[model samples]
Target: MTIDEQQASVAVIGLGKIGLTLAAVFATNGYYIFGADKNKEVVASINQGKSHINNEPGLDQLVSDAVENNQMRATSDNVEAVAHSSIIVVIVPVLVDTANQIDYQMIDAVVEDIAKGIKKGSLVIFETTLPPGDTKNRFGKRIEERSGLRLGTDFYLAYSPERVYSNRIIEDLEKYPKVVGGINEKSLLLASTFYKQALNCQLIEVSSIETAEFSKVAECVYRDVNIALANELAQFADQTGVNISEVIVASNSQPYSHIHSPGIGVGGHCIPIYPYFFINKGLNQGLTPLAREVNDGMAAYAISQVKKEVGSLANRNVLILGLSYRENVKEPTKSTTLLLIDQLLNMNANVFVNDPLFSDREIHAFGVTPLSLQDKSISKIDIIILQAYHDDYKNLNFKDFTNCKLLFDGRNQLKQEDIKKHGITYQSIGQQSEKGEW
Candidate 1:
């Protein structure tokens, strides 16, 4: 079948941020999209021309326009979506637990649904990040077994990792190069053709499906190790009265150095999780796991600084600023603030949380009291840790924190003298400076 024949309809099996964005982009580009998800509310919302994710730029309008134009629609039945469309794109999430093992419960169920209805000559592309060869060995085998069709012959299969940042999926899809690979030449050709025809993206075709899967993990592992190195150097800089942020800038002035900034911890869906994917593969487990250990240890280090400045943390009231992993995004997956909260609670400190993105009720779900910075009625706050540097927090008056004795700059974002000007002891990772400047 030709590319035009396959474009009769396309199935996007996962209506999450990345998946929904993919469906909208395809529909906008003049292709019919059948977006499938297990969540009935999400499907119903999409069918009503609504985008569930509010923060993603251009997604709401695109999805609305697509549904209005009869280009894309959503359903809960993956089997129906697969049977109706010739091109199937799977973006189901695969997460790792505390044991560093892949939890295939969600993705496995989606695969079972796909295998039951996947048609011959239909191209199946997995865009979820996976351990290097699991696309072929684990999921591909399952599909072949359930469908009774041979890969690279009866049907085509490919792997293309979804390399997108949350809240910027539409922009990243247009800008970043899409790395793609397949089980065979035919699979690669069809998947490449579909992408080229569907989206305005530059494609980097690789040698094999395993390479494409490995590329995404390697990209994230590089960041994880780089951040770990910065965290280690920050500790050394703290002892030697040198600011690690300045060190990072001076070292990176030359094009050769590209050091990542040290923080309270490395959080986010990609950086904190991908290293474990590599380590669990049993391929050179030395530095990767060690890096995870170093990054995760930063929360304890921050609390130790609190202990140094304000005596014991027991019975002290600690207010954490920023719950999301990153400053601006609403996502809270693997947030470092959660780690700090855990440490503070273990030290018997009463924890209060504040983030402009999350509501008071949502903050309470994390088992912490929400302290609005805008609240006029002043309350006792012993310590304030700046985990996320949201713009709304830029004008934070230390006077508001009169009872607060310490202002810990977890992201190295706050000014030191200003913090000290209010008699609040300022501290951050490796931020030992008489004159505090970046």
Candidate 2:
């Protein structure tokens, strides 16, 4: 029987940002998509020809077109999706607990459901960022025991880590080289061929599934280490009265010298979380752990700079712009603002936060009063912390700060002269205070 009689061309289990994008891309490639999501609202939204993720560029139109053309459909049942598709792509998240321990509960549950519904001769490709050997050692083995299926015999399993950034996933999919490795030669060959034709882009087929897993973690760890080094250099620059930003520009002119910009902290789901995977390997845990420690301490470093510049924080009106981890994105996973709020509140400082992306209720959820951009809301007095630097602050005139003493540009995105021209001292990572800078 043809695909229409029994199964779909592809099944995408998970309709989150990455998963939905993959489904839409697959649909655009002429493969009928069967999307499975536990969140009923997400499934309903997709079925109604709409995209739940609003921030991803060009996603809504893609989703609408896919659904409109009857090429894509979503369901709440994972088993139903798997049973109706010949090729299954799983792209679920593996979260970490408060103790920084990998919580495999969610992934474990999804794997079990896949094992229950995975069909004979169907290929299951995981697109999640997992620890090395999880697909082969744990998941593949478990599927064998639970489903009575033999790898490379009854079914095929492969690991292809998702390597795309938020807000640019669709573009990155076409630009970045897709990495794929499988439990065996046959699985690897199958996944590689499928991706080479489907993505119509560069493909890197590694030796083993474990290698594919390590590649993703290694990428994240390398970035974390680079960022941590920049933060350390920023600290040294502050002590030595050197401009870290200036140093980075001059140093990077060598081409071989690639120095990252220093920020308040590395606060994202990937960089901060994946370093623990590299460290937990229990081998030569050298720079990975150290980098994580340094990046995690940067939030406190920002607050320490504020304390040094303005002295007493008690009863001080401190406004924090952008509560999200970074600019433009609404995701607050492991945000630096959380750390800042804790320290500022402990110092008895009146904390006010604002992110154009987040609602007032969400801002209040952080235990800080929401600061609107209006002049009445701009009644901020003592300190202003530019945490995430959203585009809303781009044309913002500095004169709006009625009695602001210091403008701490956490990301170094703002023009220093503009703040200084308005009589407000500007401070940022790696730079001395505005008046104190050389």
Candidate 3:
């Protein structure tokens, strides 16, 4: 089939954050979208015009309109998705194991299911982040073996990484330039043409599938290293009574310098885990592992700083403000808040957690006592740690914590002077502490 005669039907394999957003985008662009997931509840929710994942701006209304207009539908049947669509986009997650290796089981299973119904003239594109050489070797080989078809001749295969933030997925998908690489020339042309028609954004075509795979991982590693540098500098600033935030702002004013902020630690699915995709591939890069170590150890380091200020955490009431990795998203994948809570409990501190994105049941499910922001018990807390910079807590009334002694801003979410004006001892990630009476 030629590019001019290609069908407008598209299939998205996963129904998580990225997958659902992609399905919605395609539906909005006048394509028939078949959104597939293994979870029956997720499929049912989408079919009913309700979003399973919450807190994403404008996603709910877009999904509702798609379902109402008969442009999008969700199902658990993989064969049904492949049989109906000419273009199949796989956006399933590729996770890393505890041994710092890419776990191939999830992607392998997804490919096996796709092979059952992939047609001869279809285009298969993977948007999952992967180590180099996995797409051309492992994924292409599995689909060919199952379907008994040639890759370049029978069908097209390509890899395009999903470069999007959780809260701003739709905007990023439309605004950012998309990178695509394929197994062959024909495959690259087909994938690029399809995305250009759907998204109408700038499309960058690279040489091979490995290049595209490594491009996304390389972007994450770049941020991880820069963040590790800022975090290491914050440790030094804390010991010497220096303000690291001020130094970073001044340094970034120069044209040659671009530094990220230092936080309690890096979190979310990308920054904390993407380095391991290259480290376990037998590369001789030492700085990658070192950066991971520094970022990973930041949670414990934050606990030590709290102990230094409060003398001891034994029997003290500690409240953590946010549980999700970032603000306004309900994703806790590899979040540093989990690590913070673990160490605080080990130090014999009474831990309480609160996040407006989550309910009391969800907070308690993480194995901590849940507290509402409006609860009167917050006034009696000994220390309050702000783990995420959620907008709900940004303009909070600091006077509510009447009995609180120390306020630790893990994300630098509040101003030191404003917090101190309430007569509470305020501490931040990379700021010099002022000696004053609370």
Model 2 RMSD in angstroms: 2.1
All models: lDDT? 0.88, 0.87, 0.88
Q: Please report how far candidate 1 places residue 54 from its true position, in Å.
A: 2.6
TM-score (all chains, Cα) for each model: 0.96, 0.96, 0.96
Score residue 191 of candidate 3 by CA lDDT: 92
Q: Distance (Å) between predicted and true CA of 210, model 3?
A: 0.4
lDDT (tens digit, per residue) of candidate 2 on 1-438: 333443347889889999999999888877789999999999999999999996899999999999999999999998888888778899988867888888888778888888888888888899988889888888888888888989888989999999999999999999999999988888987787777655777999899999999999999989999999999999999999898999999999997998899999888789989877766767336889999889989989988888888898999998899898998888898888888999999999999997889899989988989878784857566889888978888988878787888888899889878888777878999886745344
TM-score of 3: 0.96
Cα error, residue 431 of model 2, in Å, equals 1.5
Per-residue lDDT, model 2, residue 57, is: 95
Q: Give the number of the best model, judged by lDDT.
A: 1
The better-scoring model by lDDT among 2 and 3 is 3
lDDT rank order = 1, 3, 2
List, residue by residue over 393-422, the lDDT tens digit for candidate 3.
878887888888888888876887777877
Candidate 1, residues 224-334, lDDT tens digits: the string is: 889999999999998888978889999999999999999999887788888778888785567789899999999989888778777899999898899999888887888
Model 1 regions more than 4 Å off: 1-3, 433-438
